[model samples]
Target: MFLKRIVLSLFCFHVVLGKTPEIREDVRKFPDGFLFGVASASYQVEGAWDEDGKSESIWDHDTHKIPSPIDDMSTGDIADDSYHLYKRDVEMVREMGVDFYRISLSWTRIMPTSFPDKINQAGVDYYNNLINELLKHNIKPMITLFHWDMPQKLQEMGGWTNPNIVDWYGDYVRTAYELFGDRVKYWITINEPTQICLYGYGLNLLAPRLNIPGVADYLCSKNLLLAHARAYHIYDEEFRASQGGNISITLSAQWYEPESELYATASREYLQFDSGVYAHPIFSKEGDWPSIVKEKVARKSAEQGFARSRLPDFTPEEIEYVRGTSDFFGLNHYSSYFVNMDEDTINSYAVPSRADDIGVNVFKLNEWVLSEFSSTDYVPWGFYKLLNYFREEYDNPPIFITENGFGTYYTGLDDDERVTYYRGYIGAVLDAIDDGTNIIGYTAWCLMDNFEWTKGYTVRYGIYHVDFESPNRTRTPRKSAFVYKEIVRTRSLDIGFEPDTSVMTIDEGH
Candidate 1:
């Protein structure tokens, strides 16, 4: 009888295992016109924080003034030193064989005074060199106007929460359009509003740390949406006709699933708070806050004795203005979480945080091997599910995966785990396209390791690992870099194909 029971258990295990999807190379190749690229932000990669007439950004101020927030207490003051090494950086991109490169403009560098009255020639010359280098190599340039590095001068008056930033950001976008729009065809207006609002203002995890939770984050959200719409309109009306470019605001979303069938509503609530609140405003058929977000936040605020909802309202005109502003659904997805409705979860403090507002306890899967900065479980299916959700809810808008990659603290040359992660994620993207999602492009999170904000230099997310301790911040191509290069070159994934070791080289600024 015991033997029979063991046999039954083995049968069930085999059945369950067989049902799980595996990352195999047998799938159809990615569709034609699917772009492959790599992404990096200005403050994260570009050093020279105070060089060539560059003013201090919020990141510069935060890392210098309050280094405690960063894990290693390191600043981007000399990060990668891309300011001086941009030619080498572009050479690395050219070697990778990517179709394009996504980079952000440093707001403070362009307009040190945070006004258009004085345009810095040095900053203009620097971008021109970088853009020209990419163009010379046949690599298209996709520029992001802002990536959480606001000029400190602007933040002093009040950053995104001030409402006046809509115009301030508009002026900045117009300046960028005027300067580089002819050379750059793809424009990402802003990168991850949720991170800027919730993490920076509400949680105080990033630059210009406000930590105001319920009030500041919501205010920032409203203003950010307005600012994005204003920029999109500026480009569409003024620049698009001449330059023929596309504009979008990237939103970083983590796929959320219910901890169990019982917590389905909790998962949905978590999703609404994380990405829906931001996406619904610009992407939904009817612009404005997601109904669930409005209702839940209002209920929570009422419970906390607030006279009105913590989330600021959008006027009818404002909603219409913001609606359909995005040309493509620019997404920056990293990982996934399992959420459960739990009241006893810690709220950081007694005050209502974004997590507290949602009242959901989020957890990583126990099966996922936790690295210094990654989840080894690497659920690519979550990405597939996310794309399907967008298709069903947001009317199948054109999507560009603006940023996606794995990170680790280890600087090992053989990053087999990263290769596997990319294989699975990119495969899932292909699956989504076959399943009718309008995904246009995919850009790996970073071209090389640089300053990782609050985590400082602890976490590395680049295919080409940067030796931060080196005088030149040497670039070493890991095995994943070779794998990525092959994938980009072939325009197809072949799991059995081994990368050529010859492609892995140590860049000593040669």
Candidate 2:
């Protein structure tokens, strides 16, 4: 009987271990006065969609319709009810002692017709109120001009691909500068241009769904970068003098690794093609398209039968104008990976080069990690390594941690894993700062759970958990809320700050 029990135990262990490598956490250090805050995009958190003369955004239709490609088909129609409960939201910010609040402006809400010919006063007022509230509490606002919510009308007019979009985007950006530039000092010309190009045109996954991956996504990527370049030029030449504001675009990233031992030499070579092409023109020491990206895209275009490379060319003048356009860097990072860029990526996966565009095989560290990021190990040290990469590769520019947070599969107020996540992450930022990375500040990925793009609302990255069941979309402080608030109040990571279960219920109400 004892022998039988031992055999059964061994069988159960093998079954349970079908596939989960023993993951290890690498502890790291962090820097001081490295600002820590939280973030929320307009479309995800602010739910007064179509209210107060606000028209529809590209995402509204995607989340509301049948056969909705969204994982949960859950819309942000009443997300956190932040539009109404902003006061409560601010209180949370205050309690958390956040030094800055990163907020995005919905294009449809600010300019209902998707043009400057008309400004929705109600829409303007709603944003004005939110901004003023942040300033009132001494929280500086980091405003993102666009965050995936394009005006539905823009979709009808051919969004980013149409070359004419250069002028259209310029007009909208100029108007935004004129209207909100004074109050909003930090402006992101665009958010995740890679995703916009890849998902919108290539995958037919995001709104205004189009499935011309090799074709449309690549074309869109070029036009989209030009649009960003033009927008940056407008701000630098026109607005910087008067508006006295700073501008940059945000990129979503995962660390890369080459397939074999020799792959490390060309690791960044792969990154230069994927993200570097998009970023080098704007942020590199000598801003222009990386030679590798230009050569590959051009070669691929010819092979695929195009008049010219799918990538739009920038004149010498255009290159100079775009270089050094940014006053700072905005990075939205989640995880890191080992990248393989050979037939493993192309022939085997058939993933549009838009994804593994590097023309090399990209293999991951593990499979249990989840999402597109499963390729990456959750090494906080990767954050340190990435920061070092930015400093050494691109000229060391001031960077803002536009978004970073740990995601989980459950909902509970007593979230200790989140505490450890912040402990490690925030510490890593400090480590980078100590190493002279010039990281200005860090913002938590979310203030409250809202609509996560492709994954839908299933993922929660909030410090303060939102109750979807509550009619008011009530937000009660999660255990992490108290953990974060105390860190804020003390202005220090409480090495001495051991979280007790009691803090979860004890409200030193703000």
Candidate 3:
């Protein structure tokens, strides 16, 4: 099934060019106080899987135990060696002139036993050094507590599927706040719960590969939402008064465009299934599962002889607890898909799966422009629509774009495609802002190339290139890096500006 998805993803190359929106000069300038930054996750970049008292994370276990899942049979055992060369990472971001640098804390690294009973001082010191280094360079730190690298011991204890994780996660987050809340001003409780729950638990595409579709995925989602609320409440009650920081959860959202007017409802429901499952609980006024999602899953579960709906329901108290937990909507958007519904599409999934429950087929239109090296389609207008949807649905919450980037096969430094991708997407962001969306920040997906999960090193999404073969894992600035630097430095997206590719250097104060 995983291999089948991979083959389907590769079909994105068959897409034709769509109409690219013209960037008006007036819409190119970003709002004042709007932040610019780059983001990286610990498991993807931090390679000290077991170094300095750090225990194994689920990624460590998965890649080692079943290397076949990774395209290159590679592991993140030494990805970018950021555990040792974090100073160089700081330098790269400084050179880019970003206002902040977002990174995730490794659960296993800080609490090697998967609990707060024994704090790893060496792990704590390593993060302290990174945080201190960023602050010295005037870069604010935006830290995510969990970015899918749960401790293996905790996974052995049933991971997110186990309701006990609500307390387990709450304790872990409290320890993080107590240790680093003094310096870090922006905290993301968890990054992309849908990716963590659905992909990792349902699809078997990622680590921990639970793959118990419909049942396990729904259980994971329920517990994850509670865990997120627990973390938010912990920060609110304990750290917010003293630390003065903002916290939220990031969602991996992709705009789902209906294939036609006939399929509008299908697209809306697909969006609900894709991201609304998580978003509705936290951001909606009612704060339970979406009615359509509940109805659909319940009907299907009854047909399958299950005693209850496959999607776990939030109790009244749980609903209120999760409701309004986020300070801002942390979003990670990459592309868009056209959603369709028909008997054939519904029958294509395993009988008791998420796809079966959603009852929709989502695919990129052949008319959309395709990224040459990745499955992501270029559809900036879709981004514009998604922002509008969020503004209208969630009553105009402040939005922080936590991760957005173009991925590619490791082509050298002259990455024109990525530059174009950024320019188009940022233009869409400006359009959304002009339409009264409360977008406060934008973060490029990463600072440099590192371990890219299941695709392994086969795909790259970094502004700077890392030579994985080199002992230094040498970093070199790509063309997109210079383009991004200009945008950050000037606080404007000059669509026509072409940066000089001759030299890459840190600007004088950076």
Number of the top-ranking candidate, with TM-score as the measure: 3
Q: Please provide, for model 2 over 277-325, each residue's C-alpha lDDT reduced to its tens digit, 9 standing for 90 to 100.
A: 6778888767778876777777877876778876677788878867776
| Residue lDDT tens for model 1, 1-510 | 557545533432332222324567673577788898998989998899999999999999899874277889898999999989998888888878888999999999999999898999999999999999889888899999999999999899989989999999999999999999998999999999989998888877888889898889999999999999999999999999999999999999887776565666666667778898889989988889977688878998899899999998999999999999989999998887777766667454346667777778888766565454463358787787787667766889999999999888777778888888888888888877877999999999789988888888888888888988898889888888888887877788887778776655432322
Please identify which of the two predictions, 1 or 2, would achieve the higher TM-score against the true structure: 1
Return the TM-score for each candidate structure: 0.93, 0.87, 0.95
Q: List the residue pairs that clash in candidate 3.
A: none
Question: Which runs in model 2 stand beyond 4 Å of their true positions?
Answer: 1-33, 341-345, 349-352, 367-377, 494-496, 501-510
* lDDT score for candidate 3 against the true structure: 0.88
The candidate with the higher lDDT, 1 or 3, is 3
Each model's RMSD to truth, in Å?
7.0, 9.8, 5.9
* Candidate number of the best lDDT: 3
Better of 1 and 3 by TM-score: 3
Candidate closer to the true structure by TM-score (higher is better), 2 or 3: 3
